[model samples]
Target chain A: MTTLTHPKYGAIWFTLVVLLGISLLGPLTGSTAFVLLLAFGIAVVKAGMVAAWFMHLAVERRLIWFLMITALALMAVLFFGVAPDVMRDQGQNWGALAAGKN
Target chain B: MIDLLLKNASRSGVEIDKLFDLITFLVGFWFLLAEAVLFGLVFRFHRSRSPRALYVSGEEKHQKRWIAVPHVLVLLCDVVIIAGTMLVWSHVKQQLPPADAVVRIGSQQWAWVFTLPGPDGVFDTPDDIARVNELHVRSGAVYHFELTAQDVIHCFSVPAFRLKQDAVPGRLIKGWFAALEPGRYDIQCAEMCGIGHGLMAASLYVEEKEQHARWLQENAAPPRELVAFRFPNP
Candidate 1:
């Protein structure tokens, strides 16, 4: 029996594993920002790999690519559009501002 | 039209409304256009006159343009909206501007507990002022809040301030907003936590600078005893 094979699967899998390891070790840095960045970055890379290789999106039809791009674009609109109101800074009070000096 | 949507009390609230208006206009235009096209096609290709309809599969290169052109326009619209929104997002959410006041909000199933640093400007101390369901701040002053939930997840939302953050159990979320006007605003639990989720509401009083200071002083907790009274350490 013949098993299906892909030329880049092994390399992609290895990279994903390495990324997972890095993300797991990210918490050891004891920096919240660093850990968040590393985890998110790795997740994005891993997602891209899965989509490209496992999902066969790398060689899919143009229509499929178009649909995927459209979906992603819509998701971006949803995320960014709602973010402004959610993220606005509430200005500082006089007491708190003065306290920061110490 | 802006006032019809919601009351804008914060400096950022105005910007949020503007963004909302822009999005509404963009989407409204597309909605009308799509509806018009749908109605037009229905009448233009009516069954009475033409027995054979033009069945274009859109698989051919020439036929694909019918699908591609509209999709390209949609993509262009998406790009414009995303770019515009992201600029506002980075300004509001990504960059945490220096805040003059900090409040820690702990949410439970049916209540919000706000902890304000005392005169010494340190939290988790004996002098820390803790209030339930009421938060007071100075108008025009920037205030940052750290939010967390004691049990179920809750959202700390002040519609007037145009700010909302989820208070997840064991996770601290930070949010900030500045009230432009001195008024009492309602704080709603945007995320449903439990049976009494709808009842979980609070009031935010944005007062004058002088009034805020007086309120703080009046509400400040008395200093705690330095030594804990126990059974002589067992």
Candidate 2:
């Protein structure tokens, strides 16, 4: 039996904590775009760290890597595909345009 | 059969119905075919008075092809469905047609409040018309709504219009539809909010322009205690 240990684990934990702290301070900036970008970035980094280190994907075989990449690509496609509809300018008075047509 | 499924009152409702019919037909065909094949295989491969049974691990080239072919076909079906759905979704949701009116819907534990632009035709104004549990709009006109929830999450759904949107406490959602026919439709709270969720029902009246104008003139009065509610920080 063998036990594996890495000195980088402590560094990764520190980085995750720092990222979380930054995300917590995101709302104070009062900039929605900035907050959203920072939060999502932190989430992605944290998720990547977990998948690479905790889940041992860094040492996984080529087949596992291919499957993971395919899954991620599909998720990105789905998100981008649906984002256009939900992220429209709601403040614009579309009714005024319709009234002009009439 | 189509009429039995919520009456289509909006122009876009027709498109939605067409998409739904296409999906139903494809799914029904696939379901029947798959079930028939499953039953046929079960009967054909049933164990009878046989001396021995053949053991196959499906690792052979021929066996692998059988699995791969079906998998490819299933992937093709998925691609077709996704392509068709994205087209309709982009049309209905991404592209906003000219709207004749826009209203704000505020939902709480057990009630729905609709805010219509006043004579000035703008919301967040002192003159804006706010009604409880009654939404009035003109037929043959495109209408947009801004949805928000005061407390818990709720879903504003009108079956006849084929529209549903979530009202989140800290987020504003937009939804729109155009009514081609004039009638009274039911507005339901599709998401459960609280114990009073069952009572969270409203009425949507779509009438002729003249009739709708008259009704608005008679009932469009802003409540005295119209508090400006702001979205809470998450």
Candidate 3:
């Protein structure tokens, strides 16, 4: 965390509250896609705001960014690598997932 | 196997128990060995015996051998486990034999409603017998159950049969079991569905062919206006 600018916590909190309201009300549109998009898209923006301003990662060194990205990449690799075994409903030693054909 | 103590009750329960035994043995062996090695090392290199700090980085080839040997051995054990899992999955989940009797089971928030093919040996007619929290099946007969959730996700679990299947909302999951003995068993909702999930229990009756027929005859409804069974909100 090495941000040079001082953050206005009040404004940030106000923005987060507004985003939370929109996410909560997104389902009222009756579109699953819209609800999901608004919920997650706002979540991403909120997270970035917290990390960049509150956590003060905006002015961090390039090396810190690289390290963080590398950690995220490793997590992705671990998740995706095990996804096939986790998701598939095919047979293995004793049994497979209880995934039935519709 | 745990089934040795529980008395394996269904066709698939035997194989499932064997798999469970293999896993238990392997994991038990490894667990004991690891604990022994750790204790042995700790006792040998105690502070009272050796006052000087002896730091081992585990960078040397010989040091790495301890990790390597167990790594290979554990991998082999993993292979055995995966192989066993695949075989059972094929038999239980992947394959569904032709059913001697078909039952429709609907899971609601707090109860199970079983629709048995009535005396005419058919479903959805005026004679379909819908009972709450009770499932009756003939022993020695293969049964296919179409499981569905009325409102929320639930699990159809019979521990005696070693059967567990998720009853997801908007899905008809078909699973089968061949009854072995004529007895009564407990059916439990394995998944958390609502405030009353812990109370969502049922009874499974495995009756002889003749007994089941008698039950069907005794409970058979006369031809009348068809009415679907629905649970009032819990």
Leading candidate by DockQ: 2
Deviating ranges (above 4 Å) for candidate 3 = A1-102, B222-234
After superposition, candidate 1 runs with Cα above 4 Å error: A1-102, B222-234
lDDT of 2 by residue, B1-234 (tens): 365866788877788788888778777787998999998877777776444678999999999998899788778877888888898887677777777899888899888988888667777666778888998888998887777888789999888878877787656666788888899999999998989989999999999989988877776576665555442322
For candidate 3, lDDT tens digit of each residue in A52-75? 778667767778778878998999
> What does candidate 3's lDDT look like per residue over B1-234, in tens digits?
776667778998878988999999999999999999899989987998778987889999999998999999999999999999999988898788788988888889798988888988787676788878988999989898878787898999999999999886655667899889999989999999989999999999999999999998887773332255542221
Model 1 DockQ class: incorrect
What proportion of the true contacts does each candidate reproduce?
0.00, 0.00, 0.00
fnat, candidate 1? 0.00
> Model 2 off-target regions past 4 Å?
A1-102, B49-52, B124-127, B223-234
- Writing each residue's lDDT as its tens digit, candidate 1 over B121-149 gives 78766677777798888899888877777
Best by TM-score: 3
Q: Model 2 - which docking category?
A: incorrect
Which 10 consecutive positions of candidate 3 chain B have the poorest summed lDDT? Answer: B225-234
Q: Score the docking of each candidate (DockQ).
A: 0.04, 0.07, 0.05
lDDT of each: 0.78, 0.79, 0.83
